[model samples]
Target: MTEILEPENCFCQLASGSKGNALYVKGGETAVLFDCGLSGRELERRMAERDLDPTTLSAVVVSHEHTDHVGGAGVICRRFGIPLYITEATRTGSTKKLGKTKAMDIQAMECGKRFSVGSLEIHPFSISHDAADTSGFRVTASSGAVLGIATDLGIAGHLVKEHLSGCHALVLESNHDPELLYANPNYPWPLKQRVRSRVGHLSNEEAATLLDAIDRSRLSHLVLAHLSEENNTPDLALAAAYGVLNGSNTSITVAKQNLPTPVLSF
Candidate 1:
């Protein structure tokens, strides 16, 4: 049987939020999924809405073992017969969450190592997050287009800034607003503390500060993702990032929890 390939140098945010997070990236004939947080059914539906065919996916690469990042991984791999890539620690920690499922190919990846999926080269780097062995990726296509992704991390440090330096597009986290998160009465004290910790998610201000440290000379598109539904609004996140990127030619968009962003191509 022959398989049709997806378009070259394209990226899309299937879903992004505290609710779930998934991203689709295709370079040449190879298509890879960054995370599968949505249920299998929901993920499939959203991909279809974007005219993407799951069967064409080359692999499902995981950033961490958190439920919001790995919940739908098992089902998606089982259904599409695609390989699942993650660090050994993440695989071990997520065993219970991933559950038992039909046999599928699993590949262990190491942080700071570069790997290839068809014509796309992926470099995974360690990130600071609560999950075991969380990673941020820099994917460069055969066409020389680079897409850098750094979500679920509390801070974007020197390593992250270095990897994301020359990206053409970026999907960065703007998880919350400190003021809104602190004022939200629904969240308990410990939860708030965790969110504000060094290993927790990045607030809007933190994300903007990280952007300030990075080189955006070649950056054309920036998508703010993994927003907190309770403490962050699209307008707020957009404003923070827009403030930092005011002089650049980069196009900005805030990813939605319930919808997929438009397919961005380079």
Candidate 2:
């Protein structure tokens, strides 16, 4: 008798090392990319190391048009003719920077809509941020496992919390510590105020508070992401989130700036 192999649920941080963020999720043969924040060569090298073939990617879902988030998007899209998905507002903004491509290749999804990319179901929720049409996503794998991707958000909103409530894994933001940002010498007063506002980035406290609001019973993995290079340290972010976890069974890790995190299995 022939034996059947079980498929594993895996998520890899391709560029979660520093200011930039990108992730790859695989459920059996169906692979979906979360963000393309690195250069094409770097992304290629990293994927190769993981034994992933770029042509096998199902689709690319973008969160926003920040250069760090979309740097390698154009290259990958054109290279494989992959479907690029985002909101209409984000698509418009992307065109302003990326220029017109094959319109047929762009899949425009409305906020709060649930859609499928291969075997994965994606739910895009609106987030408060300075960018136009910023969003976070919840992905449901074929195995019924759920993963939430949220970063570069200002404060957690009703939608974000509701969608993120029951995920098995979450890539949540821990952008900066309030004290570190306020004490930074490089930022001007206006920029400092912007960072502190509800429409700007989430502070470590805000990230922790968001976690506090969630139901932690089923929370398996929580990765602190999109940390500020100048204003935040991994130790501080870890400490704050650890305090929030308060000795819960949930596991936590600080996504590093230069090294890709191992594919976390659920």
- Among these predicted structures, which one has the highest lDDT? 1
Q: Which stretches of candidate 2 lie over 4 Å from their true place?
A: 1-7, 17-19
In candidate 1, what are the lDDT values of residues 140-167, reduced to their tens digit?
9999999999998877789999998989
- Quote the positional error of residue 38 for candidate 1 in Å: 1.2
How much lDDT does candidate 2 score?
0.81
Q: Between which residue pairs do clashes occur in model 2?
A: 17-256, 17-257, 17-258, 18-257
Count of clashes, each model: 0, 4
How close to the true structure is residue 86 of candidate 1, measured as C-alpha lDDT?
89
Q: Kindly list the per-residue Cα lDDT of model 2 for residues 51-116, writing each as its tens digit.
A: 667888888888888777776777777777788887888877777545446643888887788999
Per-model TM-score on C-alpha atoms: 0.96, 0.92
lDDT of 1: 0.90
Candidate 1's displacement at residue 181, Å, is 0.5
